[model samples]
Target: MSEENLRAAADAVLSRLVGDAGGTARLRVDQWRAVEALVVERRRTLVVQRTGWGKSAVYFVATALLRERGSGPTVIVSPLLALMRNQIDAAERAGIRARTINSANPEEWEAVRLEVASGEVDVLLVSPERLNNPDFRDGVLPELAATTGLLVVDEAHCISDWGHDFRPDYRRLRTMLADLPPGVPVLATTATANARVTADVAEQLGTGGDTPDALVLRGPLERESLSLGVLRLPDAAHRLAWLDGHLNELPGSGIVYTLTVAAAEEVAAFLRQRGHAVAAYTGRTENADREAAEADLLDNRVKALVATSALGMGFDKPDLGFVVHLGSPSSPIAYYQQVGRAGRGVEHADVLLLPGPEDEAIWRYFASLAFPAEEQVRRTLEVLAASDRPLSLPALEPLVELRRSRLETMLKVLDVDGAVRRVRGGWVATGAPWSYDRERYDWVARQREAEQRAMKEYAATAECRMEFLRRQLDDEGAAPCGRCDNCAGPRFTPEVDPAALEAARGELGRPGVEVEPRRMWPTGLPSVGLELKGRIPPGEQAAPGRALGRLSDIGWGNRLRPLLEQGAPDGRVPDDVADAVVAVLADWAKGPGGWASGRPEAPARPVGVVTVASRTRPLLVRSLGERIAAVGRIPLLGTVEYSDDAVDARVPRSNSAQRLRALHGALTVPGTLAEAIAGGGPVLLVDDFTETGWTLAVAARLLRRAGAEAVMPLVLAVRG
Candidate 1:
């Protein structure tokens, strides 16, 4: 087909698809104009809308416009499995022949390749990992090169190290397209991007030859129904208890964010003790498990979820009421992207943050994990350059002669450096281009340093948080996000649960037995693989502080510290605090607190604990599980279930009478969970972590219309 004639055919096909998306698919004037501009201008574009400002609409319109021009099939690269599935579903609903491919099933690659090459597909959604395949670059992409339409890179900020969620492979995308036929256009989109990431996209696309015109599309950040708030907790125990008490107050779906995988699991366990339906996700988990977690959250089968930075990338669940951060996030961009998942689907939402001083230490630890040493970076690049083809870690191990763990660390560092590529079965040398530009290597190093500095700044920012994010994401025209922590005062007020305190008061002197689970510190917790005998270690009182001290006295402090302070005390204790503590402990031990049932279920046996934390609402375990397994072709929801029997012991503690009195003293105020959910009042939905907005969708729908006027999400960070 002639180029001009082909372009026309592609355009026509896309228009037909757009028409099929229903009347609701029509883009607003501004959004339509943005899509037209990308097509007509042939330059880089940045679309920064609020959670639901028709960002997808802009991309869909752009996709149609490009496809109609007879450019063959357009490639839409996204980070989320849910996004790919949903986008494909939307395209099909709109009558577009949309197909997607990923690493989930190597067996299906041939069929997908044929579909792409035969031009039987209008659009193809793929993961960056999939694109790194030599067969992909040399096999399918070239088929449509002569007529390939628009290459839409979603979440484009991932290209920059400075981006909130940096994906090392994203930098290699431009390289993969280096051989594409002329006239093929690229459209990059992101809800959030810092100046550096936006510029990187432009530079990679060679847009406007160093003077690409960037567009700013703004939507209302002022969500009246979404009240923003922050919670400053002194310890983990009180934070957790507070979380348990407030879980039901959340509208429907929510997220709780923690700093580490261990923290995610710990927070989830504490919540499960109260009979909350929760699931967890982390990078360490198998893709199958993540798929299940995503499914549960989407179907609303699981009410809560705990996870690290891995849950939100491409997942989309719009009915969230709140997103909560259990600790401080690493950067403003990360925080913004994570919480942006809330208040989606035209419902009210909340973003909340609960930061402790230790948050800084936690962030630093994360930084140390990703920040590679120069020697490691250089060695990784050298090995990959020496190999003619992709190599797995085992194949390259002898080349480096480093310990397996150390080599893996170097590979991770290299992956972040964009110097390495992770193929389906092996790693490849993607950095030969880096060798030609030593300065680029230096730039990578310097950019990493700058990112660390930015992380520090984000953690310590005193200005309006929304403003900080706007600047970071290159939304220079963005005004103060009047809804965030920096623009508004603290939303989390110092309050207590009167009913809980009253209960505490009456139970404090009841002479209830204490279990290790209720201890101030979870000391002598059995290590993984140990059998549970329902035994408490000797000399360990089940009091919160003493237990913690004992755990710290031993080598188990790191594991117990965060769990103890999951929720800070509300300050309303009864006269017989001791009795209340014992009563609470006893209830927990006998009921939901059994070690076998204390944790939530997972697809596989728990190798260790994993966490899912968010800021706005309670975690969305069911929805997250559904999406993770939804990869391109799988229907994992309702097919998989989880078991929390991995937990070995339940820590129990006696509530001292004095403690009960203190708790009682602080919880007499109004606006408790009951009050907020009753009559017209504010109801805060809290979670441990939130990456994408999906986790908070349910809560937003349930609480926004009830007398609860507002839903807020406070999270530690947002993954890119």
Candidate 2:
């Protein structure tokens, strides 16, 4: 087809996609070029366009044109459920039949598969995770690969580790790309990928010796409708207060993004108390709730949805009038992707960032969960190589020390590297010698740190915020937008209402978070000779406890995180924190879910206190225990002694299995302390922080075996 014919077909498809509005919906030159590349040239292409630039139109129009020519269905590998939903709706608008297979609609997968096999579906959307599903990969994927007319990878930046939101599952697309029959044009689109990420993804899209080169379409990353600003607040209180005061002033229903789930919940709750109809949307939120929240935001029924990064990518609310970030993201690319959610359709949308002091702390916490050390990787491979049969994640939990999530992530990476294969039952070692790419991993880590530094600079930069973001995406055309805070002066005031500030302070400052006791031991604990399984014995289990705050909470978390951080100098508990703990205890005595709230099964008041010996923060732990003991008028029975050898050989707090192995038989109760607590009322177990809760669990079990009536954990902070 000639360029003119391809352009004409794309315009027609755009017309159908937008219905009556489609008449005037002519394709941009870039859009037409992308369509031409995919449909006419039948080439692999990467469209690095900004959000709301009609990247979807490129794929949808190409799909329509390809299907019109009797090609098989366009298979779109989307990242988020929200994105898939939006794509399906858009496809329908273009008069194209669309179907999806994801975790949410498992029951409909069979029907959707049948539709695809029967050529009744014009486009099919599947999440990157779906590509690795044993059944789907073995049974449905091969057929799809053989017949797919066009392959579309939306949010394709996820395919590159250098991308801000790189996903291990997205790497599985390489196999599908390799398996596709000849002449299947591919399209990879992302609104956020730097030059490095683009090159990486483009290289992955290349078919080595077999496929033609991918046409890379890099465009300007700028959003004119967004008026960006950064408001460095004094604390979480001020941030919340600012939102509470200014939320009503924003043009339309929008989103408030937080860095953590707890912050989202807290902000949503505070907003609700302020009479704003807002909902919390986070990874922890139920799917039904998330769907309802999305609907409420779409219909303008809710003021905003306070959310974490989970609310990002593919959420479509064209007229969303504002986007407020309660905390800064780690990277400018990620920040752009999130703020891009706003001002996409409207002429103007408020985009503000109220960066918190704890943002870096949150970033570091996430950084700790990155890829494991080479030794750890080798250990995993060795364990897998020793196994005779495929081992499920749960079954491999004991054999490997990595947590389930991290383990699965490693396996996915290994699968992509040809070191392992995920079969029908579980994962199997492929017997392939895999070298640990230390340089690559190290470079990635360094890049992450650089990104973090760049984000900090972004918050403090005097240059145009939009330009800074654009430059981060490696947009050479980036320039001062002349509409941002730095370019045009502050669009929002730093002043917050005193009354609102106090209210926010009170709400956020109020302490006490429930610490649910671990019920069952981690799966496969028996394989390590721990002999623990099933539900924890009622008598041996610690009662549901209370912490001063969660480490992820915007309010108390800010105050407590620094003290409990890994390398922070250990000292006696701070006076302010001690007071907060006292408040928590008082609330625990009288609050709705408190033990003294007339609950039938609530444990009785503690008669003794036992401190868990902390190798890193002994003074902090001891002081906390002594303070609690004094406040409760209970005896400081004794401390759980950590064996000296055990302290010297302490294992890194990596995963459940490792923690359990390290803690097992590492804590011993003194005979005198055991007798003192033999018939006492419930005992208070004190610790500085609870990461995996394994330490507390081990302490509780030992105390119970030593004849304590019950154990109740009280800690400064709980890790989310």
RMSD values for the candidates in order, in angstroms, are 18.7, 1.6
Candidate with best TM-score? 2
What lDDT does model 1 reach? Answer: 0.53
Kindly list the per-residue Cα lDDT of model 1 for residues 284-314, writing each as its tens digit: 6688888788788877787766777776555
lDDT scores of the candidates, listed in order: 0.53, 0.89
Q: TM-scores across all candidates?
A: 0.62, 0.97
lDDT of 2: 0.89
Q: Which stretches of candidate 2 lie over 4 Å from their true place?
A: 1-6, 592-602, 644-650
RMSD of 2: 1.6
Error of 1 at 441 (Å): 7.6
Looking at model 2, report the run of 10 residues with the lowest lDDT sum.
644-653
Provide the clashing-pair count of each candidate structure: 177, 0
How well is each residue in 205-297 modelled by candidate 2, as lDDT tens digits?
A: 996577987999998888999999999878888888888898999999999999999889999999999999999999999888888999999
